[model samples]
Target: METVRAAERALMARLPEGTLMQRAAAGLAAACADFLGRVYGSRVVLLVGSGDNGGDALYAGARLRRRGAGVTAVLLSPDRAHEGGLAALRRAGGAVIGPERALGAIERADLVVDGVVGIGGKGGLRPDAARLASAAERARAAIVAVDLPSGVDADTGEVSGAAVRADLTVTFGAYKPGLLIDPGREYAGTVRLVGIGLELPPDPVLQALQHEDVARLLPRPGAESDKYRRGVLGVAAGSARYPGAAVLAVSGALRGGAGAVRYVGPAGDAVIARFPETLVSDQGPDHAGRVQAWVVGPGAGDDAATVAKVLGADVPVLLDADGLRLADRDLVRGRTAPTLMTPHAGEAAALLGVRREEVEAARLTSVRELAATYRATVLLKGSTTLVADPGGGPVRVNSTGTGWLATAGSGDVLSGLAGSLLASHLSALDAGSVAAYLHGLAGRLASRGAPIAALDITEHLPDAWRDVVRD
Candidate 1:
């Protein structure tokens, strides 16, 4: 990030040369020691690059050598190696090996430290560095990355080519946006933060929801609260071909904060059969009577008319699946009430007219771009669900959810849950984020280790909500 680099430059100027590097090396060595268990007689290999990243690994290698471990530094660029670091490693009994010897040393190593690139590096690993990365993967050695992982874009979380898969990353000062997002987040494995006392700005590039944060935002009905006062949610979903979508959506809404659920769709029989509490109607969303908020799309198939009718309402609207495809862009941008869009990578790519891979590679950028273009709250669902407000403040990344959540009808459940929260009068931003956190939690609880249906996720919503609100 430009701001982060500027701050780093300012801080480095004030501090003595090599002081920050020394602090970083100390923390790195301590982490390596813990991983090694017994430092004495342990074989450690360092993949050294050309910058301060390589210097940090060399210095940490020297520390390990002093404690009786056999340390070997594999120089990717012998001509560009850090002179001082090389001298210190030699003095501390560390050996410098060539790229030809890196594979053999790595195979026998107890631990391997990746100092091939720092946060400022772009694209992916180079040819020589990529060779070592491949060897590291094939070896039994536990890989530890210095700063951010090699080849990951620190600011954007994009990975285009070959990159190191770190078993554990020791990041100094602060977390890069890449570490928290997908693609890069997957390559990063597990992360350990080693603070070196650099003062960062108060507002971070991303924010994650905690249980306490979720508890504070949940709506609770007062003693005098009636169904109207508590909140009413209108759901326009499902059809003859996908009546289950309407059933699942209403299932989610009933367990949500909304006091009443109004179903206006062709799946009225299915909805009333499953949930007799719902007020079913044959008319469209325009004739569904008054509702605090409306959920559109999700298995409505090609029913653009129902999507259009719901979009015309004055109430807060949440658009998902088919609704995201069928809505007029200009009308969405011109709405008076708050609007929320939930799209997976494919739908998002369609909206932006880009490839799905492009959207997945640059999730943070895509989410923000969508929010700015639509001028509304956008929830980008994937490995990490991110909610971006129109203003581009810190995006909320949902920490919950499992890979098992990538099932059918999941988006439908999310739509109903978020729309209910909107009906409860939360700002679009809070409603989307809070619902995402709970929905993910429910998925995790439902699946645990096995596969779960979309309806199962909706069934667990009450448990998830109580888990958040419980003292």
Candidate 2:
């Protein structure tokens, strides 16, 4: 929020008064017109508030009115409304109404512009505003939010109370973090950025990797690359209780661009049965042949010894599932080698000593806190997977996942995939982010709108990889 505010303030200083608002209003009007296929005879309702956001909507409503649409501005605070915007609406033949008549107008309109709150507004909407938001949600009209869906934290993506759920959010300047992360993301149906020429810093608070970004980070084996030269990932996972975990982990590692996967644990037989090519060893990770990186603790039921051994290996280690529980925080913090910790909201809550709901509610804060506490790159897996580096740079957010990924053994595959990337010499941050992108894409491809098993995701890894590096 502060970063956006600072940028807005800097931009507004050089621009003439009302110039920014007009630009934003123009973009909003254009988007609304595009959304309403035939705007000439459509009814548009503006849920105008007291902030500049309200001004943008009012001005947009005026533009719609001039285009032969019946526009009505329902002001929550008539006296506090944007003076210039209100005058423009009045001059353009747009009608004005108070909150008392907002419900009827919203129901009668073909589109509802939610400018009742903006990014600056915190917590939730006021009583009257909430009522209008509720009415807008119940109405048949398509809802459009200006800048951001009201009542969502633009910086954290947290929603405290009643918020506007828009069919489309026409945001100006830049994309807010809330637009990408969920509950807030769920509220913002589809986001459209309207560039108004505000200069932003190169390093943003959050980073979402697209195909080009992931392709650049993906490791490709060179002509001279041997198995060891390409990368070798070590897996110390599973137990007598859950041997499939080891097999799944190795499955993902094999497809994760690693030339070789070395397995060491009680599940060696199962690992070898599934993937005969894997170098299987009954000896612990300590005696396992040299490898570039290690993935520990997927269904590792009570294997604190193995987790500790992998931690001491002096190579990049991906800690997940049971590993996240058994690994020592002091040891994790003391390690000089890069460490990537993958934990779902439940596991993260255990690490942070908080409720799962709290961690889920504030995923950004929780991921950062976990990274700081463990002194490692932390990936908080959920609807929006986040990778936060211990040193506090921009956190990478991946939204490519489907709800079907909640199946068991999914984290195991992710751990192995990320560890393989680590072995390939990507930093913990890059490895985790790239692994998440690929994993999510694989999930989507494998599922294809249906339920899929964990192994299904591994099976589609090649397809996902090809899609990324493809032209």
Candidate 3:
């Protein structure tokens, strides 16, 4: 779904006068009638605002009236309702009334349509409107929003104040950002888009990658593939303090279809102890001997020397955790091969010199900025993990991650899986997103109900792969 703000220019250029409004009203009426089973004899209350949004509600009410439904428009703004729509509603047997009259009628209705605000409006419900909507919330009928649940910012997806708690939100054209993000997302309920004759842009501002997309990107083993032919992933992770991180990373790499995983660091012995299959050596990235890709900084701490050695390598690198902290953007810019950065919100904020809240507010924009700034493919991890390539196109938000995947050391597993895929010769964006989807699916399988350890996530990779390949 693309943000509403991003489509304003195109909408203004193409939408004829009242054309989008009519399309919106028709879609809204259809959805409401479908939900009510039979709109004839059903009572619907329209909470009319002062803009085109109210116009949409009033127009929809006219349609319902023609079908023998009882419709009432509760005008929040006394003299500000859409004039043409208000007259049409009255001509079609719908009554316009004050809040007190509207409240009593709303209590007896089967459904309430909230037209309090629309895409252009910012902040939350006004005090009078908030109280009225709150009362409707306690009523017997379901609350359906006209454009979006009013009071949620269409641009940033943040709630300024109290928003109508809707059972369903019928949006026009593309989706607004507020419909997809956290606090605002909770109040939106199930969102349905109603196309209003707008052409979808070539590259959406934000996109959710589906299962088929991820399945197409998986590595297929060929007949000539050998251990080295498949690819070797060099891991420069772990220290005396956090040896388990290295173990988890190696575990993910081994299970991520990498032909071999070379572990290099002070915690090499610890890594080998957990997984004897991993080739452990104290040698850094340079001496790791012809690795296809390097996975750096999972648990290496703040050691400058080890981080420098890893960064200096000529191979494709997946930088995570401490590697992100130690990065010099200029050096990353000079890398000849592809580079990928995987960071959680906080780490991403630090790398981009912004607050964590800033990264969360405009996640799609922030991820793209991070990708462009570092000239690398950036994987911003969270509930909606986004992968943005530096050159720019649609940003992919992984909709597969489970909340159970929020546990510690889970990111290390992601980095290892992504690094392994990169080593297997996939493009940076494809490798990162594919690893995320598999890791997220594994997290769900590992933690059917209770909490799951990071190591448990490693064992489910094959299951995820099988499901994708089979489908």
Model 3, 180-294: lDDT tens digits are 7655666788898898866666656566666787788887779998889889999988888998878888888888777999999888888888899888888676677778999
lDDT per residue, candidate 2, 295-390, as tens digits? 999989999999999999888999999999999989999999999999999999999999999998899999999999989999989998999999
The full ranking of all candidates by TM-score, starting with the best, is 2, 1, 3
**Cα lDDT, model 3, residue 224:** 90
- Screening candidate 2 with a backbone cut-off below 3 angstroms (N, C-alpha, C), the clashing residue pairs are none
Best by lDDT: 2
TM-score of every candidate: 0.95, 0.98, 0.84
| lDDT per residue as tens, model 1, 102-170 | 888999998999999989889999998999999999999999999888999988778988999999999
Q: What RMSD, rounded to one decimal, does every model reach?
A: 1.8, 1.2, 3.6
Question: What are the lDDT figures for the candidates, one per model?
Answer: 0.91, 0.93, 0.85
State each candidate's clash count. 0, 0, 0
- The positional error of residue 469 in candidate 1, measured at the CA in angstroms, is 2.9
Which of the predicted structures, 2 or 3, would earn the higher TM-score when compared with the native? Answer: 2
Off by over 4 Å in 2: none
